[model samples]
Target: MAESSGGPKKLLWVMIILVLLSSAGAAAAIYMVLDERDDDNPEAPSEEVVESKPPVFLTIEPFTVNLADDRHGTRLLYAGITLRVEDEATRELLETHMPQVRSRLLTVLSGQEAGQLTSSEGKQQLAAAINERLSEPFDENQPPPELREVLFTEFIVQ
Candidate 1:
């Protein structure tokens, strides 16, 4: 009877020792995984060492254009125009060709009625067309000037 009780106690002790050893091994593996991650990224990047690019500047000129046709039975036609151009060269090119731009815009807008211009989709289409026309003069090989956006500052039809 005494020997049987001792055998069971030894079995319990063996199980306890195995459980402790397994837990210690799992802890060691976890520590090694964390340490390996630390070694991968030994140094952090310095914020001060980074440099950023300067923002590009854009300018617009307000235009009040007169349409040829009087769709609304009135002679007055007014539109606020803005041009989005990139550098000085492109700006100069647009400035030099102001008469052409005006002519092109007049031709494009003259066909549209007051109701068409009032719609959001109409305005977006018009802007896209205008952008396309404006970029026509630039060489196809080189990147065209980035037209930021077209805004209708003031639109009046009479």
Candidate 2:
């Protein structure tokens, strides 16, 4: 009776030892895989992080324009445009040609419709067109402006 009781206790201890060993092995394997992945990755976080220049933001005065319409009444669009630029030099360049930029924006905005500006796709297309027009050379010999993005801080149609 004593020997039989001891047999079960020994078996239980062996099972507990096996479970502990398996868990330890699994943990070690996971650690090794993660370590290997980090070593293999080129953009590892272990390297030093270099500080980058913040994007330059320039806000233009809001625009209120009558959208093209065929109905009995007029449709109006009000938008505040914010431009993202690369550097101080680019911003300075834009400042010098602000009049031309505003003129071009007005031309583009006047061509849009209330229904067109209401949709997201239409808004994006308008943004793209404005970016293109703004980035174009003011003169035949002048270089294109370095305008990164055009964001509408305020956009409304009525």
Candidate 3:
């Protein structure tokens, strides 16, 4: 009876040690994996640590022009455009060449049909056209203006 009791006690101690060793090994593996990840990506900035620049916008005055006849006798488009320029230099370039900018906008607006400007796709196409035209350099010697977006604040067709 004494030997049986001792045998069971020794078995229990062995089991407890195995469990402790397994737990320690698991903890070490987890620590190693996390440490390796940190070392592998040392330069990755967390979202909270990232910095962003504010947007710059350039607003153009409203335009009223005759749309394509489309056999509708007469049609007109009234649009207010705002340009999202890449930087202050682009905005200044547009402002300095206000006459040329207005001329280009008027030409694009007047060429659109009233029916085509009424839909969402048409409006997007119009915006793209405007962006393309505005991106052209005012001076052949200088780089073209960088336009991020062409937004129409107001659109009315009659």
TM per candidate comes to 0.51, 0.79, 0.72
Query: Mind giving the per-residue lDDT tens digits that candidate 2 earns over 1-158?
Result: 34565887899999999999999999999999999998899886665788988889888999999888846368999999999987888788788889988999999999988887889999999999999999898879988888899999999998
Q: Model 3, residue 148: what's the lDDT? A: 99
Tens-place lDDT digits, model 1, residues 40-92: 88585545766754433333444454444444653444677676566566667
Residue 52 displacement (Å), model 2: 3.8
| Model 2 Cα shift for residue 87 (angstroms) | 1.3
RMSD of each: 7.5, 2.6, 4.3
Order of all candidates by TM-score, from best down to worst? Answer: 2, 3, 1
lDDT of 2 at 48: 70
Task: Report the lDDT of model 1 for residue 42.
Answer: 50
Which candidate gets the maximum TM-score versus the true structure? 2
After superposition, the stretches of candidate 2 with alpha carbons farther than 4 Å from their true spots are 1-3, 119-121
Ten residues in sequence with the least summed lDDT for candidate 2:
1-10
Q: Per-residue alpha-carbon lDDT of model 3 for 28-66, expressed as tens digits? A: 999999989987995977668556657779999999998
Q: Name the lDDT value of residue 123 in candidate 1.
A: 80
Scanning candidate 3 in windows of ten residues, the lowest lDDT window is 44-53
lDDT of each: 0.66, 0.90, 0.92
